[model samples]
Target: MPNSSANQVSVIALTQIGAALARKIQGQLPISQLVLPEKYAVDGEQSFGRCQFKATCQMLFKTSDVVICIMATGIVVRTIAPIIKDKTVDPAVLVIDERANHVISLLSGHVGGANAWTNRIAKLVKADPVITTATDTEHVQALDTLAQRFDGWYPDFKYATKLINGRLAAGDRVNIYIDSDFRGIVTDLTGFTEINEVADDRFDVPLVIISDKTGYPKRQNSIQVIPRVNVLGVGCRKGIPYDAMQAAFVAFCQQHGLTWRSFYQVGSITKKQHENAIHYLAATLNIPVKFYSADNLQTVADHYSQSAFVKKTVGVGNVANTAAELASGSRTFTDRFATDEVTLAASRKKLKVDDS
Candidate 1:
């Protein structure tokens, strides 16, 4: 089994069964259902309502990395399919038994770390792991052998598991840039895009998702590709004058045609703990941010796209660079700013993003 831990993950449950499971798995994992007061409920009724379902599911899907559909009379599945069918973040769909804690990895089990998760749940709840994915049953094979297929170029493809399979079928090459010997061919791993599977970084790759996963992709011949056309993020005091930050961010975005969502993470001056501006930006851009402390900024030395003036003055890359780097999962970006100084930077990762 793949050894991994739950870092930043989100969960969505369709029914009471799903909600119960979500609550049980809390702390050990991430969940989508948040306890809300009756007054805040959209249904204008008591605890749960149809409106609540719609609004809750919408919010849940937005932040979730996976969606777990609890089995019932199948109403739960029916109610939430349309909402999820069109979601941008392809959530790993799983079906769990309401009666027993048994977890069935119906869709995404490996690529989204559901396989490992399945076992964890089984042991915790003392239930069965009904993992039907072929890769899990068989140890040797490419991701294609077990990957669930879905439509590429669709917002739904963002579902990690479905997208992996779709990318493989679409002829996206898997450029494994690992150093030392690594087991399994490119085809053997679930959702690999490349057929060559050779241990060479020189192979062509469209999307480069850098991870700390060892021996997967070698560094020697790897090329750095910024995955976004524009990246803008800002950090300021609680009520600091928004002029500089807003101007910088807007100017940078206007200079490049990029959607607000492209801005990934926000690196702020540690002193301004939980500032209002960050919350406002999150609302405006509709993107989540992974806040970084000053020390964490050091690891991104290589990827920081710092300008001469920005670098000389702030002594770090701009916010856009940090956001882009963090969003793209690359270590080649970082930015810094003072409490009063709201900084922004931009990248061209959107140069050739597929519209299809």
Candidate 2:
């Protein structure tokens, strides 16, 4: 199975039959089964057997990516209400009947991925996925979900959900402006206008802008979806704190007017592969990390700002600039920016689409 730690799922069962069903589901999917002390059976690193359901659900709801409760929906709802805070940060909650006849997505249907999980489980168990979200029933896609699917990000999600999808749900026209030809990222273009540029006077209708430009199309009703086109090359001292690395990167982006969400991936030297801070930063940003050897970095060294000290210490003339070019497989988009310990640079990756 894939890394269970990365995509953690907690399954809680109240009855023996439910526990049996939970085990079956866990065997099929990459998940950790949580059962009472008396019903503990599965033994492995993946099993979290012998735990209180209410407490486990409360804890996992905050920590796990998704939570599956195989019991009465009412009981799961009442247990989690006290701890629930924001739908954006909350884990997807799914409630399935003990008999495995039905699967209902209870909370965070879109942003939290509950709706998708419900459909997957329903298919496996031959049960109906009861999705209560209006957008799913109305055949209107959620903007946040679309952003995730395209490896993009949007700010003010609540406002976008309320304004953009709301207008579409009411049968209103919505305009989408992309600086480049990226229509292939979107599957449905039924009620959207694909334009090369958005006019300043086009603020009356809902708009979705996908671009990497510093600043363009300043409007209130427009939701900017930043495409993952830039590669972030990073070089940091060993044992650096994750927060420091993240803060330095954020500051660099702000100074350059770059959107951190537009970063396609993070690149570093292969020696730093075991560095916890690097992995932590990549995981927190939801971006993959690419490692390059000293030899690989040397191939792009001539195109970057070379440093004798970096060459002497790390066997490379430059770390950030070379890694950025190597990661993007293109020229540098901006000059290298450095902090006391961390260095960051960026390169643009061109987007291509078929005309036909």
Cα-based lDDT for every prediction: 0.44, 0.78
lDDT of candidate 1 vs native? 0.44
Error of 2 at 3 (Å): 17
Off by over 4 Å in 2: 1-7, 34-37, 40-51, 189-191, 234-261, 264-314, 325-345, 348-356
Candidate 1 lDDT by residue in tens digits, 28-101: 65433333223332333223344565565444444456655455526545655666553224455555676555
TM-score for all predictions?
Answer: 0.39, 0.72
Write one digit per residue (lDDT tens) for candidate 2, span 1-356.
Answer: 11234347877777778878888787787555454335444454233435455666676677788888899999999999999999888899999998999999999898889999999999998999999876677777667766666557788878777777777666688887766535675666545666766763366777888766566756677888887888988898888898898899888888888876788799999978888888888898798999999999999798876889988888897888888889888877778888888988888775544232
Top candidate on lDDT is 2
Cα RMSDs, all models? 12.4, 6.5
TM-score of decoy 2: 0.72
* Cα displacement (Å) at residue 55, model 1: 4.9
- Model 1 residue 246 lDDT score: 56
How far residue 260's Cα lies from its native spot in candidate 2, in Å, is 5.2
Worst 10 residues of 1 by lDDT: 147-156
Clashes of 1: 27
Off by over 4 Å in 1: 1-22, 30-47, 85-88, 141-177, 180-356
lDDT of 1 at 299: 52
